[model samples]
Target chain A: MRGVSLATPYLHIDLPQLRINVRRAADQAALVGVALRPHAKTHKSAEVARLQLAHGAVGLTVATVGEAEHFVRQGCRDVFIAFPVWVDEGRATRLRDLRDQADRLAIGVDSVESAGNAGRRLGHTGIEVLVEVDSGHHRTGVAPEQAGVVARAAQRAGLPVRGVFTFPGHGYGPGGSEAAAHDERTALETARDSIQQVGIEEPVLSGGSTPTLAASLTSRAATELRPGVYVFGDAQQWELGIFEPDDISLTVHATVVSHAGGRVVLDAGSKTLGADRAAYSSGYGRLLEHPEARIVTLSEHHAVVQMPGPRPALGSLVSVVPNHVCSAVNLADTFWVAEPGGLRAWPVGARGLHT
Target chain B: MRGVSLATPYLHIDLPQLRINVRRAADQAALVGVALRPHAKTHKSAEVARLQLAHGAVGLTVATVGEAEHFVRQGCRDVFIAFPVWVDEGRATRLRDLRDQADRLAIGVDSVESAGNAGRRLGHTGIEVLVEVDSGHHRTGVAPEQAGVVARAAQRAGLPVRGVFTFPGHGYGPGGSEAAAHDERTALETARDSIQQVGIEEPVLSGGSTPTLAASLTSRAATELRPGVYVFGDAQQWELGIFEPDDISLTVHATVVSHAGGRVVLDAGSKTLGADRAAYSSGYGRLLEHPEARIVTLSEHHAVVQMPGPRPALGSLVSVVPNHVCSAVNLADTFWVAEPGGLRAWPVGARGLHT
Candidate 1:
C-alpha cells in the first residue's frame, strides 16, 4: 500500500477522529443510563470493534449470523444479530454453533412464525431471542400489540425470550427524528407490556438509529441503544447537521482524472464510494477539498464532479465523504488508516459476508 | 461451495449460456472483419477471459492498469487499458514493468496533457497509446477534432500512437442504438482524419457497446469492437430487447427471508445485487421466478420485492437479474458456475482492481 496522498480512490480512515466519535457515543450512552451496543456492521473490523469495546461499549450489534460468527472468532464476547433473519437449517446450525462460541448471543424475531422457526431450530441453546416491533419503519418487525403472540410462540418451543427491539429507520428523513423517536418509545413500551402479558417481566427494550440517537436519550422506556453510522460520520450525517465535517472519520481519496468544461471527473465512482443517494442528499458524495463541488453522476469507475468555480488540477488527490459510509466500507477490502507517521492498511473483516 | 438451493444471495452463472454468448460475439466480430477485444471488466475472471480468447478474441480490454496486470499474471498475452487513467510516478513504474510482461500493451490517453505526462513518464517503454474520442457520450475522451493534438503530443513524447477508440455509452438509453452508432461512426471517421493529419496513417478505429454492436456492423471505418456487457445479459439489456430472459446467464440467487403484507424480503440487496439503476430501468432487479415481481427497495442486506401475485414461501430460492451485470459482478468475489451435474466456484480474478 502507498501513502494516503498516492492511493487515490482509497478509503482513508482518520484514527484520531474515529476515537473521538467512539468515545462521544459511549459517553452519551453512559449518561443516558442505557447500555451501548455499537453496531459492528459500520466498520466491520476487529480493530475498530476493540476500540469501541475499549471505550465502554457493552457489546456489538451485528446484522447477520455470518457477521456474528466473524466477530465471535475475533474474541467479541457478546453479539446481537439486529436483523430479523430467517433461519433455515443451515443458518440455524450456524447460530447454534455461534451460541456455543459467544458468551452472549441474541437474535431478533419479527413474527410468530420466525420465532417458532428459531425456537425449534435452537431450543434451550442459551440463545436470547428479542421480538422485533415495528416502530414506524414498517419494513420489518411485527406490530407492538402483537409482541405477546410472538413471545408465546418462542416460549412454546422451550426457548428464552429476552425483550423487544425496534429500529427507527424512518428517522432518516427531513425533520423526522423527533417523531420517529416518539414512535420508538411508544412501540417499545407497548411491546414491553405485551411481553409481560406473556409472563416475561423487566424486558430489555432496545431502540435507536443514528438520526434518533440523541432523542433516544430522553426515552426512559429504552434500556439499550444501537446506532451504527455515528462512529463514521458520512455525507448524510454532515448534511443533516448531526455532525461536523471534521467528525467524518472516513473518506474515499480520489484523483482528478479530467478537469475541463466546468466539471472534474474523479477516479472514484459507485464501485468505490457506493451508490446510496439519500432523499435529502445533494450528490453521490461530498468532496472534502472543495465542499461546494457536487458529485452529480457515478458510473462503475468514474465519478463526475460538477465544480462550483475552478476545477482542481488533473492528477491531484481530492478526498470525498461518501453519502453512506457503511456501503462504502462494504465495497472496499482494505482501508488506509491515517496516522501521524503515514498510513496503515486494515482489512475489512466482514466484507462480502452478506450470507 | 454448496448447491444453489442453499447458497442465498450467490452469483449463479450458467456455463452453457455464457459459452453461447462468448461464441456469438466472436463470430459477429469475425463476420464484420474487426478484431474482437472483449472487455474483461464485465466478468473480471481469468476463466471468462480464457473463454473469450479460445473463441478468437484478439485481446482483452480493461478499465484499469491493475486489471491489466491481473490478466497478464493470469497468462493473458494481449491487454488494453481502455480508460484514460491518471498515472502518478508509482503507477508509471508499474506500467513500465507491465509493458515487459504483456506481448502487447496499450493505454488510453484522451488529453494532450495526459499524453505529454504519459510520454514523459513512460518514454521509450514500448507501450502503445490510444487516443480516446468522444462519440456523443460526453463522459470522457477528447472531441474528434482534438484527436490530432493529443496524437501529436504522444508522438513527440516518443510513445507509439497506434489507434483511436470510443465507447458509445449513450447507446444504453431507450431507443438510442441507431443514433449512437451513427454518432460513433462519424466520430471515429473524424478522429481517423485527425490522426492521419498527425502523419499516422491507417490508425486503428475502435468502437462498440452492447446496444450499438449490431448497428456497428455498417461502420466500415471501424477495425475493432470492444463490448463488455454482451457476455452477461442483465435486466437493462432485457428491457431494451437486446437479450431474451433465457440469455441472462448470471443471476443472484436470493432466498425469501420475509413473507409479509404485499412484499417478500429477499436475502439479496444492494450489497449483493448492486445499486445500479439505469435511467430507463424500473426496479433494482428483476426476479426470474416471478417475472412480474420487482425489487422495490434495497437496504444493505435486505431486498424488498413487491410481488404481483402470491409471494414465494420463506426460505425458497429465487433468481434475480441485476439492473447492471457489471456492477453486480464487481461486487461479488466468486461466481458459482451452474453446470449440468453440479456447481463449481470460480474466483473473480480482478474483482477490486480499481487503481
Candidate 2:
C-alpha cells in the first residue's frame, strides 16, 4: 500500500497464483493424456510463455502470424497460429518468414480459400495445416463435415494436413464447458472419420478451454489442448467456475482517484481492464478485494465502481479482476509480475503488432 | 484505393479537415471575445499544437503533468495541466523540472490535500495553481462554493492561486452541452464573486468542450476555452450533432478479414478502434464508408461488424470512425497523415507515456 504511486494504470500478475493455475492446467492436461499448448496471445509475454514451457507445455499457440513471429524471435520454437489465416500477398510473405524461423509451425485453415492460400504461401516449406472444425463456437471454423474437404484441399495444394482443431469458446458460460467439450469430441471424431474415409491419416486433434480441458480428456479424439487464458485466470473464468478467486492470477492494480455519490473512480479504466463484457457479465468486471463492488462504467482513464459496501478512501489501492485477461493484456504496454520475492516487468511483447 | 495502403489499423489524419476544425474553433472563440486554449490531450502531437497556435490558440491545456512535460519539450511556451494533480515525491521532482522548462505553467488544485502536497513539493517555486470548480461532472474538481476555500488553501500553502477552471464533460450528451455550459457559467461566476468578496482577483475563468463551446461563449464569465476532441471529431461528436461526418478529420484504416453470416470482421478490433463506448454510442464506433454497418463487438484483433446491407468481401479495405478518437490514438504505435500526394508516419509522440 505504501508503494502505491500514481503512475499509468497496469495489470499486476501474482506469480504464486499464476504458477498454481499453470500447474493445475498442466496436471489436468496430463490426466487427459493430451499436451498443453498454452496460447501466448493471452499474456503475449516471453516470460509467461517460459513459465508455461517450464510447466510441461509442449508448445505455444498464437493468434496471428505477427504474434508467431514475435514469440519465435523471443526464442519460442514450436508455435501454432490457431486462428484461420487468410494469406494475402503481404501476409503470405510474413507467414513464410515465420514458418522459416519456428521449429514447428502449424496454421489453422477453415475454408478451401484459406487452405489454397496457405498451400500457395507454404510451397515446399513443409508447413502443417490444421483443419478448423466448428465445435459450437460459430465465430470461426468450418462445419465438422466440411473439415475433410478443407483438409483434402490443403493436401492437394501440397501442404501437409495435421488432423483438426476446434476452440471450445462456448465453454465460457455457466455449466457450458462440459457440454462444449462433448461437442468438441463429437466434432473432432466426425472430422477424423471423414478424413480417414478419404484415405488420409489425421495426425493431431486439438481442442480445449480452461473450463473444458478437464472434461475434454475423457475423449481419445483430442491429442492436444490449447488453453490460453488459463495461465492468467480472469473474472469470467471465476464466474464460469473455471477458476476460484484464489486461482485468479492477474489483477489491475489501481488507486481510487475519486469517491463521491456512492461511486468510486479508479485510475484504471478500459485501457487497463479492457471492454470485454458479455451479456451475462455481472458488470464491466469484478473487484479482487470488494467482490460486491460492480464496475458500472469505464472511460479511457477511469473505471467507475458502485461500491456495495464501504467506499475505499481516495488514494486507496485496489485490485480489479478484468472480465477477460487476454484483452486486458493487450491494452497494457507492459505487466508487472510479482514472482515470490521480486517484481519484474514483462513487455506485452506482441501487443498491437496486428500487422 | 490502389497504392493507398497507409498502413493497416493506423489513424489517418486529413490535414484539410483538421485545419478547418482548428480555424472554426478559433473563429468561434474570437467571436465570443474569449481566448482559446486548445487541450492537446486529444492529439498529443506537437505538430497539431503548432497548428492550433497558428490558428489563434492563446495557450495550450493538458490533462497530466506528463503531457505538460511533452508539450514543453516540444517548445510550447504556455501549458496548463487541467486535472487536479496529486504530487508525490517523485512527481514533485518532475513538476519542478517542468516549471524550469516552461515559460508559463499552471496546474489544477481542487482539494486541500492536493494544495498542501503541491505547496510542500513546490517549495516556494511560485507554481501557479488553478482551483478546479465542479460545474457538473462529478469525476473531479471541488464544488462551486468550495472553489474559494480551495484557492485560499492554496494561498495559505504558498502556491500562487491563478483562477478557476471547469470542464463541462457532462455536457457531451444529447442536447446537454448548452445546459451544462450555462451551469458552468453560473458556477464559475458564483465562485469568482466569492473569491472577490474575499478580496482576491481571480485572473482566469476557463470552460469549454466541443459540444458546449458555443453555449459557453454566450456567458462572459469564462475568459478562456479549452476544447480538446474537436480537432479530430469522432462518431460520438457526429451523433451529438457537434460535428458533421465531413468534419471528421481522423479515421482508422482497417482491412476486412472475414465476411460471413451477414457480418464482416475487420482486422482493427479494440486495438485500433479502442474499447470506449458510451451508453448513447451507436455501437462500438462507425464505419466511414459503410455507415449502415454497425460494429457489434470487438475482441483484441477482430471487430465483428453487422452489416445493415450487403457485406463487404474479404480483403477489402475500410475506414472506421472510432467512438472516441483520443482513445483510438492511444492504442496505436503511430499515426499516418494522408497528405496531398503521399502518407507520412508520425510517432504517437506521447502514446503509452501516460503517468
Candidate 3:
C-alpha cells in the first residue's frame, strides 16, 4: 500500500540500497588491491554498469557477445567475455564489430579447438585472449596444466595471450567460500606459472564470486576480481552468510491477489521471482517481510504462498527476495529503482537479448 | 548443421503447427456441443486469439485482469477472468473500467468473502459472476455444496450470478484425465442442482482440459469448455498421450554455443524453457530432434545439454519442446510466426504486463 504502482508482481530495486551495495563491493576490492571488474551479467543494465564504473570498477565482465555489444553501445570501453569463446563464421563477425567499439576486448579460451577458432576468426584484430582454467566450477574452462598449451595455441593463431581466469562458483555452498577461494588461488597460480614456464608474460589473473571475494583478499595470485551478484545480494547469498539481510538491494514487489484459509496468493509468479531454487533451498525463495510465509508453488501468473498464521487481506503488497538475482533480472523487461522514497524506472535494456 | 540463426537461446513456436493446433481444439469443442472459450493465458498473443475466434471460439479466458484488458483492447468483446476475483477499493475501480469496454465481463468467485467483495464493488456494473467449484483440482475453488451459499451471497449483495465453473487441472498427471473429468461432471451437476434448489436458475456449467475434454463429452452438466495449453502442446502433454510428437506446436530454437568432450551448451537457458520441471520430469525439457540429449542444468544465459554420443559442433541448431509452454511464452517479449511457407512477426502484446 506504499503507492504500489508496479504492474503487480514486478521486480523493484531500491536504488539507495543498490548504490550502497556497489560502493561496498568497490571499497572492499580497493582495500584488497584487486581491480573490481564487476560482471554486468547480474544487473544487465547500462545504468547499473555506469554506477559500478562510477564507484571505481576498472572494467566489466559479461557472459556473451550480445551482452558485451549492449554495454559497448552504452559507451563501456573495456569488457571481458568470461565464458569460453567458441567462434563460428557468424559469431566471428559479431566479435569483429565488438572489437571496433571497445578500447580493449578480452575473450576466454578453454581448449585448443576454441583457441584455433578464435585465432582463425580474429585474424589480425589483436584480440586479447585469456586462458580459462578450471578452478572448482567444473562447468567450463580447462585444467591448469593445459592452460599454457591453449595459450600457446591462441598465440600461434594470431590472437594476443592476455592471462588466465577462473570462476569459483563452487564457493556458493554452505561454508565453502574459504576453501573454494583457496582452490581458486591454487588454480590461478598453477595456470599462471604454467603460462610463465612457457615464457609468455601473462598479466591478468582474474577470479571471484560474491561468496569467494572476501576470502580472496589474502591471495596474490588474482589481480582482478569479478563479482556480479554482490551488487544485489539474493536469498542464496544471504543463506550462505555471504551477505546479511540488510545487504539485499533488489526485491520483487507483488500484490496479494487471493487469500483463503491461511493461504495467500501473490500476483508475482515464476515470471517475476524466476524458478531457480537451488538444491539446498528450502523453498522457491524468501519473502522480505513475511519471513514465516513460504512460496510453495508458482504458475505463470500466480505465486501460491503458504502463511503460518492467518492469511493476509486481499490487495496487500509484499516484497520477495529471489533465490538467484541473475535469473530474476533476466525474467523482467525492466525494474524500478528507488532511493528510499524516490523510485525511478530503469529499463533492463538487455533483458532477453541472450544470444 | 542446419542454418542456425544467431538469435538468443529460448522457445520459438512454429507458426504452421500453431495454426493446426488452434483448428484442432476449435473443431473438437464444436463436435462436443459446447462453446470453446479458448484460454489466451497460454500463448498471450492477440494474433493467436484472433485466430482462435476465427476458428469458432465463442470467447476468451484469461487468468489475470491485465490479460483480459490486453485482449479487450485488441477487439475481443467477451472475456472471462477465470481465476478467483478478489476485489479491494483500488482494484474495484479498474474492474469497472474493464466492464465499460467489453460486451460482457465475467469473473469467478470461489468463496463468500470474494462474493461479498465482488458484490460491494461490482454491483452497479452488472458484471456476471461465476462460482468456481473444486472438481478434484484441489488448488483453488470451493466445494460443490458451497456453490449455493456463494451464489446466495452474491445475489444478496445485488450482483448477478451466472452459473458454475471448474478446472480439471489434475488431468495434467499421468492417467488422471478420465477420473478428473468424471469428478468434474459430478461437481458441476451438484453445484447446478444446489443453485437451482435455492430458487435461482443456473445458466452455465463449464469445465474442461485438453486431456479431459473427450471424457467430458458424455456429461451434460458442462455447457462450455476452456482449454488453453492445447494450443501449443508441450512435453507434459506428449508424455500423457494427449498429443503426438507431430501435434507439438511450439519449440525452442537454440544454437549450440559450446561443444567440448561430448558435451554441448545451448544458448537457451531457463529464461527460454522456464524452470517448470515436474517431479516426474527427466530434465528441464526435451529436445525434439536430439531426444537422447538431456538439459542437465541452466544458468541465466546458458544451458548445459549432455548428449549421449559425440557433441554437435558449435553453431548447430536444435529445437526443444518445453515442459510447460505458458511460462515459456511469458519470458519472451515477441515471437516470430513462420507459416508453412510464409513468414510473419507477431507481438506478444501481453508478455510481461502481469498485474
Candidate 4:
C-alpha cells in the first residue's frame, strides 16, 4: 500500500495481497477436494465475497440473519447463516424475505425446540437446516451424538435437513490445530452416522477454521469447509504460527501521535483496531514496521507501544495487524484499499449487522 | 424500554433514566462550581449531546477531529478534542475547517514538537490549545512539571494556550477512584502553577472521570469537569461501586437463543456488547435480569451464561449491561430509545468515524 499515508486509524487492505490470500485458500480447498464455502464474517464486504465466489467457493457462510440479508441484497445466490439462530417473529419475517431473495438459504440449529420454532415460523420459506455439532468447541451446538435429534426435529417440522456443521473454534490457539482437526473429523463422522440412522445418508459434513483448514484435510468426512479470516491473516494467526506475516492482507494505518523515549503511542486503539486479545495471543496487536515493538496498553483512542530500538517520530505512519481480523473489520464502516491506480474505499457493508 | 422486543441484540435506552443521569451529572457539576463539558465520546449521539446541553453543559468533549466535526455539524458551538493529536497535513486541513465551523475550538497538545507542528500547519486558525498533564494514569500526557514547557511551545507557535487537562482514567477501578481523585487534584494544581510560570495566569484547569467526578469535587483546583460514561452507567461503573444498579440507563436487548439446563446462551456477544473487560470488572458483561449469572465465555455473537437458578425460557428477551458502554454504543448504528409515546431510533451520529 504505497503512497497511502494520508490518514490515521483507518483499516487498509492491500488489494494484491487480498487477491493472493483469497486464491491461496481456494487452492488449498481444491487440493484437498473439499467444497469451500468461505465465511463472510471476516471481511463483510461484497467485494471480498465476490472475490471468494470467483475463486470457486460453493457459497457463503454468515453469522447473522442481517449478514445473510446483506450478501443476498448484493446478489449472492446461495447463502448460509452459520449461527444457531433463535428465530422469533421478527427474524421469521426477515428470514422469509431472505428466502425470497436468495436462490438457496440455510440456517444452523442445535436444539429441537429452536428447530420446531423456526419450522413453525418459516416452514413455507423452504430454508435448509444444518444441525450444529459441538465438536469439542461446546459453543452453541449439540453434542455429536445428539445431532440426529435436532435433525429429526427439523425434518418433522417440514424443514429439510441438509447436513451437520461445527465451528472447531478450539483450533485458534497454541498447539491446538492438530487436536482440533482430529476432534472435528471425529465429531462430523459421528454426527453423519447419527443423522444417517434417521434416514439422511450422505449428509454434507462441513467443518473448517482458519487455524485448522489444512490440518482438517487429513480426513475425508467433511464434504464442505467454511473458513473465515483466511482472507486477511491477523496478528493472532501470526502468533499461533498458522500464517506467515506476508499473508496478512489487512492492517490498520495509524500515525505515531505521542512518544517518550522508546514508548510510542499510535492514534489507532481499541476503537479502531478492536479489543480482542485471545488467551494465547501475544498482545493487542503488532506493528508491521517494528516487529519487536509491543503494544502494551490500548484504550479508546490510544495504543501504547514499547519499542526496543529508536521509536518513530510523532506523525510517522505505521501499519498495525489486528489480533482478530473479524472483530477489527466489524469496527470499521469502510475499507481503504490500495488499487492499482490509487487509494479507493469499499463499504464494510455488513459491518454493524448485529441482529 | 417497554414493548421493545421486536429484535435481538439491539441497544435499548431508557429515556427517563438517561435524562435522570444527565441531570444528575449536571447538578453535581453545578454544586462543585465546575464547568461541565460532557464528553460526547460515550454516546456519540447528537440527541444525547443536546440533552447534555439542556442540562447546563458548557460544551462537548470529543476524542478526534472527526468527532469534533460531528458534534459541530450537529449545531454544537463549542467542542474540545480532548486528545493529544499529532497533526499531519490532512488533519491540519480538517482542524482548520473545524476552527472555522466551531464558535470555540480547542485541542490537546502533549509535546513541544507536536505543538510546533500544529503551529506551523494551523497557526492562523486561532485554535486554542490545552497542555495535557499526566496524572497517575500515565497513558498519554506530559508530566505535571512539563505542562508549562508545552504551554510555552504552543504560545511560541502562535496558538493560544487555554490551560491544562488530565483524564484520571485510573479512577475506573476497584478502590481506585478516591486515590485517583486525589492524584487528579494534585496534578491539576501542579500543572496550573507550571503554566502560570509560563506567564499564563487563570488557566483553565480540567480534570474528571466518571469514577472520580464526585470525589474530585473536594478540590478547587479544577475549573472544568469532563465525564463521558456517566450518561449511561455500565457494568464497569457498577463493579467499581461508583454507580447504583438503578443508574444504568442503557442495555443490550438480547434473546435466550440456546440453553442446556442452567447453561444458557444469549444472542449477544462481543460484537454487540463489546469486549472490554478490565482487570477489576467481574465478567464479560452482566445480565440485568439474572444478576448472579456468570457470563462464562463470549464469542463473536454468543454470550454463554452460567446461571445459578431457573433460567429464562427459549426465545425469551433479556437485557445485558455491557462492560464498557462507549464501545457497545460504537458498535451500533441506531439507538432504540423508549420515548413516552413509543420507541424511537436515534442515529449514532459519529459511529465509525475512525479518522
Best by DockQ: 4
Candidate 2, residues B32-67, lDDT tens digits: the string is: 789999988788888899999998898899877777
Cα-based lDDT at residue B260, candidate 2: 35
How high is each candidate's TM-score? Answer: 0.97, 0.93, 0.93, 0.98
True contacts kept of 2: 0.18
* Residue pairs whose backbone atoms clash in candidate 4: none
A34-127, model 4: which lDDT tens digit per residue?
9999999999999999999999999999999999999999989999898889987678888988898889999999899989999998875789
lDDT of 1 by residue, B144-243 (tens): 9889999999999988998899999899888999899999999999999999998998898989988888889767567988989999999999988888
Return model 1's CA RMSD, one decimal. Answer: 1.6
Candidate 4, what DockQ?
A: 0.64
| Error at B311, model 4, angstroms | 1.3
First chain TM-score for all predictions: 0.97, 0.95, 0.96, 0.97
Residue A137, model 2: lDDT of 73
lDDT of 2 by residue, A1-355 (tens): 2353536466788888888888887887787678889888888999889989988999998887778888999998998888767667677767778778878888888778778877887856878888888888766678888778888889889888878898878887888888899999999888888777666774688888777877886675698988888888888888888788887889988777654334687777676677778767888889999987888877656788987667887666789999988878887788888866556787889987766
DockQ (C-alpha based) per candidate is: 0.54, 0.36, 0.45, 0.64
lDDT of 4 by residue, B1-355 (tens): 3433467889999999999999988987788688999889999999999999998999999999999989999999999899988887778888898888889999999999989988998776789999998898878889999999999999999999989999999887789999999999999999998999999989999899999988877675689999999999999998888888788999999988887433699999899988888988778999888889777789999999987778889988889999999999999999998877777999999998867
Question: Model 1: how far is B246 from its true place, Å?
Answer: 1.3
Stretches off by above 4 angstroms in model 3 are A1-7, A197-199, A340-342, B1-4, B88-90, B198-200, B217-221, B340-343
Report the number of the highest-lDDT candidate. 4
Candidate 2 docking DockQ: 0.36
